[model samples]
Target: TRHDFGSIPQGQVATAEITVRNTGQGALKIEAVSTSCGCTSARVEPTTIPPGGEGRLLIRYDSGLHPDSGPVRRYIYIASNDPDEPEVEVIITADVQEPTS
Candidate 1:
């Protein structure tokens, strides 16, 4: 659960979508979706997913709110009701750089 957005310039906003699939026998109920920091935010489509069904996790990271330049790291938390695993973690990274105009 890791994504690297190479070279995001200042003032730019980066976004990505992650797919969550339920391979188990029962339905996967997504309780909540959140980000580690204010600079990042996330949402999940269709909180309830039937077996073998998939859902999309929309993530947004605003470089302007990131506070600094260079390499940056953020996290996306997925709270769900799974027998073995209750919480899922997604990691996001970006090379925050100055815009070359």
Candidate 2:
């Protein structure tokens, strides 16, 4: 899944939510959630999702760590018990704008 935060001010923290659905017949258990860099963090609520149910993943990025104005991309890795897809990647993008003096 992918999420775009559009434009945000530098030094500000940005957040995005991603929904994970369990379409399979068995329950989905999220084993771990990790971010690509130290500037980003992610967590999954209700790590277990019943069949046909859904879960929420909260992702936070620290724009201040970038220290520049430009397009930024971050990734979140989700490890789950899904047999078909044990791992999934979520991408987040944003255009950081410089603060005015």
Candidate 3:
């Protein structure tokens, strides 16, 4: 799934959860997950998901590092056994704002 987190204040910790499902007949394996910015971090569970199963990608943002108000985007790459859904890219987006000083 994709998300547009709107906006967050600076120095605030932001997080997003991306859930993926294996709707195919074979097992699903996630090769890697990449972020658009260094201030963002992500982690996946199991690294592999069974057929007809679901998995989650947890992403965290260090707003302290990326302190601004605008649009931001992050991407995650997933690799699976199913040819039809062998590779998938998930997106996360948000706007960061500076915390009132």
Candidate 4:
């Protein structure tokens, strides 16, 4: 999955709310939520999701943690109990604009 914050001002925080669904026949348990950089953080609501149910993946990216004022990319990893795919990868991106004085 992928989420783009588009263009945002420097020294700002951007948020992305993603819907996570369990399409399998068994319960989906979210084991862990991690990010590639300290600039980003995320969490999953209700950790355990029933079959066909859905949850929310709330992510926050702070541009202040990242210095470069251009396109940037980060990652979010979600470990789950899915048989086919145990780990779900989310690519988060943003375009950071210079702050105006």
Q: C-alpha displacement of 45 in model 2, angstroms?
A: 0.7
For every model shown, what is its TM-score relative to the native structure?
0.94, 0.96, 0.81, 0.98
Q: What digit string (tens of lDDT, one per residue) describes model 4 on residues 1-101?
A: 99999999999999989999999999999999999999999999989999999999999999998778999999999999888999999999999999999
Q: Which run of 10 residues does model 4 get worst, by summed lDDT?
A: 64-73
Candidate 3 overall lDDT versus native = 0.74
Task: Give the clash count for each candidate.
Answer: 0, 0, 1, 0
For candidate 2, the lDDT comes to 0.92
> Best to worst by lDDT, what's the order?
4, 2, 1, 3
What's the lDDT for all of these models? Answer: 0.90, 0.92, 0.74, 0.96
Error of 4 at 45 (Å): 0.7
Error of 1 at 33 (Å): 1.0
Error of 3 at 101 (Å): 3.1
* Most lDDT-accurate candidate: 4
**lDDT string, candidate 3, 1-101, tens digits:** 57777788767778878777778777777777667678878877878888889888888877777546667777766565667766667777777775577
lDDT at position 6, candidate 3: 79
For candidate 1, the clash count comes to: 0
Candidate 2 residue runs with Cα over 4 Å from true position: none
Local accuracy of candidate 2 as per-residue lDDT tens digits, 1-101: 89998999999999878888899999999999998999999999899999999989998999999778999988999999999999999999999999989
Arranged by TM-score, best first: 4, 2, 1, 3
Worst 10 residues of 3 by lDDT: 76-85
